[model samples]
Target: MREVMGECLPDVVRARQKKAFGGVQGEWLRKYHKRAVYGLLRSASFKKREYWNHLALMRKADAFFAGEGENSFFLWQCINLELWFRKFID
Candidate 1:
């Protein structure tokens, strides 16, 4: 494959390190879908869960929004879990 397309592809494109294909979910969560994500994360139903520390969750979320940390994976998991509960258990 490299031999066949290497001539047509730019050096950078052909020689670049491989990376896992990923979605912009983290960016979307932090930017485009911020309001909706925040709403779902902070909703009464979500906050009602005793396992999570509401204040800590908010602080963590604030940090993520402020670019103080890379907690997108954690936040994404939390959001998915909440959505799953709402869909199947709530």
Candidate 2:
């Protein structure tokens, strides 16, 4: 995960420089990451999808946190999860 994020950091930095950090660019990035995380979670050869379940639970926790108070944290979690999925899946 660190390696993938490291590789993607350049592009993310570029996007920030271009002020393309939101709207469509942001949406696309989010989707890409979500897919990558999902793929990673699904990659284990084990019978139980533990990683996938853990990720899902984390997402739910993020949602709950957002609802309770930490809106930014929730959004960050969501974006992180999506990015994770995108990086791993593709």
Which candidate has the highest lDDT of all? 1
- Model 2 weakest lDDT span, ten residues long: 41-50
lDDT of 2 by residue, 25-84 (tens): 334434454555345334443114334455555565445434543334444554466556
* lDDT (tens digit, per residue) of candidate 1 on 1-90: 767999999988888888997666779888787788789877998999876787788888889888997788888888888888889998
Give lDDT for model 2. Answer: 0.47
How much is 88 displaced in model 2, in angstroms?
Answer: 0.3
Q: Give each model a TM-score.
A: 0.70, 0.24
Clashes of each: 0, 11
